[model samples]
Target: MNAQTFGPMSGEPVGPAFYLADEEHHADGGGTMLGFWIYLMSDCLIFAVLFAIYGVLGSNYAGGPSPRDLFELPLVAVNTAMLLLSSITCGFAMLAMEEGRVRRTQGWLAATALFGAAFLAIELHEFSTLIAHGATPQRSAFLSSFFTLVGTHGLHVTVGLVWMATLMAQVGRHGLIQANKRRLMCLSMFWHFLDVIWVGVFTFVYLLGMLR
Candidate 1:
């Protein structure tokens, strides 16, 4: 409502100092955060279902290769490291942004993008190697589930990389304005969520496969 309208409702005179923008902006921030969190929760449900499916179908190899024959711990470990490092760099970017150090924030964001790219490259290589070894998704039920779970995660990473690049450009152009800072926070949450998911995959899928 306009100031005059509000003033009449309050039975007081309107002041020149009143601003609706401040209230709107504050509400906008809270709304954006809430919307994104709801989105993340939905994504959590998607992954939960995927994990459940994989758990049920994981051992149905149809006499084909199991995780032991397919998984390379050394390469998987390196891929995990790449993603974990990206998380660190992303955190550093947030800190820099908090301090209003635009150049440092941009540098750290760039570092994060590099690590994210490295993670994708390593994942792609692993997929290619598995396919080359005749462990295609259609080879067995186990292979199908593995590819679906891991490939879905890879797809998320690819999108994250794209978002990271876009956000970097935005920061470069806008210099960490409030909008850019908000976007950065959302990206950080997303990237860290992926990191958490990968940890689950590593332990449940990779490590447990070794034991089984």
Candidate 2:
């Protein structure tokens, strides 16, 4: 009877198994990033369409209130600051994550969530004030476009906050495991993307609208 050796001393199949596992892990990571990029692209397209619609119809106020008449630049500026600050705090969280500091990462994430919540609160207040003043979407083409664009962004921020809360719970339970780290990275991208889109909105929808 021939003796069978399954040990590494006889150059068994352990090395190939590990290599395949590593390959599969890498593939999974790459796939996740790719899928996330695709999702972001789709979101970008949605925003682009909204922007285009606004450009076409923003001036048709139907003899109603215009941008300068309605938009409170000072308040909007404060809201923008909140979002921008949240982005910075989110970056700090990512740094902590990279350093494997779970507590610090969660702290930064909590701070970011707070800032994001503040932003949403301000935006909601603005919306409510506008609606109370009879500047609703049904009033004019301009108001319709304005509400659609800004409201969509606000909805995204709300969703992001919920997502952040879920992630915080996961981090507390999992302590920055590879999956949690990947989720954080994805959220980082999403948060920064919203920041960029808001800048465009502030510039085109608010700043230029005020001038027009």
Candidate 3:
């Protein structure tokens, strides 16, 4: 159960044509997938605690802006679509890789990155908008809990974008090596995992807040 070092394939003379056989490639792929699942479990633990805190403090607006006062459904909808689109584009990238189309794969990866960037931009805008309206996290217990849950999700997206860009650079420099391919697949899981978490964020933080 040792974690594997992800890079060029073994005995493949790391300079050109970095091909790895299906066996070696699949082994590493399984390892990467397992590792990512573990990471996601840890993230879930962190989110669970945040959700509990938010649950306790969610109604304590303390004479400050409430969810109905602060949330713009249309803006949050747009942000949600951005993340969903990125997840789709990331799936396309994986498909392209499976079919051995390097150029097309890069194109899909680039599109995914663009969508992710858009999501992050909207998130930053939303945060700024809230702060401008005096809805800062420090303003109330509700706000503090709100920012912690949503901000943690935003931070994950930021890291995912960075990871995508680094993988894209590797794809360009080394072409579709098996390890790189496996790593890309792992990233696809991470990207989609974030998207799923965003769904929860939208449901609990946005929808439930608005309802309550």
Candidate 4:
């Protein structure tokens, strides 16, 4: 944020970018959504760079296992389904919120959290299995790139689950007020964004990796 020196025009209130302490100013919620979109775009750039790195280094097995030798596509497919279904439940939660059904919204949020947790569980199991078979990140450049790309995504989902649970608790305590609605909208976007990213991961990393 640039410092605003006092001038002939310095009496005006600061923009949302420069000021966030005024909750009343942001009660309309436009600034919050725009800020969230900016954050998502930044997140997209990070993932894009990760994908490019994987494309370059994913083949450097360093005399270790290749994707076909390590990737369990069946298990990965199941994990993908869990995440994709969680997106659906997240959408349902948003709908329930719009309808002012607090209980239904919380229920769907809980479902989304469960599905997200299952996805993470499967991913961790896959990681442990690979490490058990000596396919750790240090084993090869391929494994290094693989873990970097996929693990970053898993970390995001873990954060989303935590956020979802906290938001659910807030909704339970406060109902579908304006504040909770704004949070619900933000979480909906985040959950769906992760689902889209996972589709790319499943196709580019898992499916195409198997083909390699």
Q: Against the unseen true structure, what C-alpha lDDT does each candidate score? A: 0.90, 0.94, 0.88, 0.92
> Which ranges in model 1 have alpha carbons more than 4 Å from their true place?
1-6, 9-28
Error of 1 at 131 (Å): 0.5
- Cand. 2 TM to true fold: 0.89
Question: Residue 49 deviation, candidate 2, in Å?
Answer: 0.5
Ranking by lDDT: 2, 4, 1, 3
Query: In candidate 2, which residue ranges exceed 4 Å CA deviation?
Result: 1-28
Best by lDDT: 2
- Give the CA lDDT, 0 to 100, for residue 201 in model 3: 88
**Model 2, range 118-154, lDDT digits (tens) per residue?**
9999999999999999999999999999999999999
TM-score of each: 0.90, 0.89, 0.85, 0.89
Clashes of each: 0, 0, 0, 0
Please give the RMSD of candidate 2 to the true structure: 5.1
Worst 10-residue stretch by lDDT in candidate 3? 11-20
lDDT of 3 by residue, 1-212 (tens): 43334546664333222334445655657756777789889988998899899999999999888899999999999999999999999999999999988889999999999999999999999999999988999999999999999999899989998998899889999999988888898889888889988998899999998897
Residue-level lDDT tens digits of model 4 in 6-73? 43586764555344445556779987999999999999999999999999999999999999999889
lDDT of 1 by residue, 101-184 (tens): 999998998999999899999999999999999999999888898899989999999999899889888888988888889889
Clashing pairs in 1: none
Candidate 2 residue 32 Cα shift, in angstroms, is: 0.7
| Candidate 2 pairs with clashing backbones | none
Task: Name the lDDT value of residue 98 in candidate 1.
Answer: 99
Candidate 4 C-alpha error for residue 9, in Å: 23
Report the poorest 10 consecutive residues by lDDT, candidate 1.
13-22
Candidate that beats the other on lDDT, 3 or 4, i.e. the better one:
4
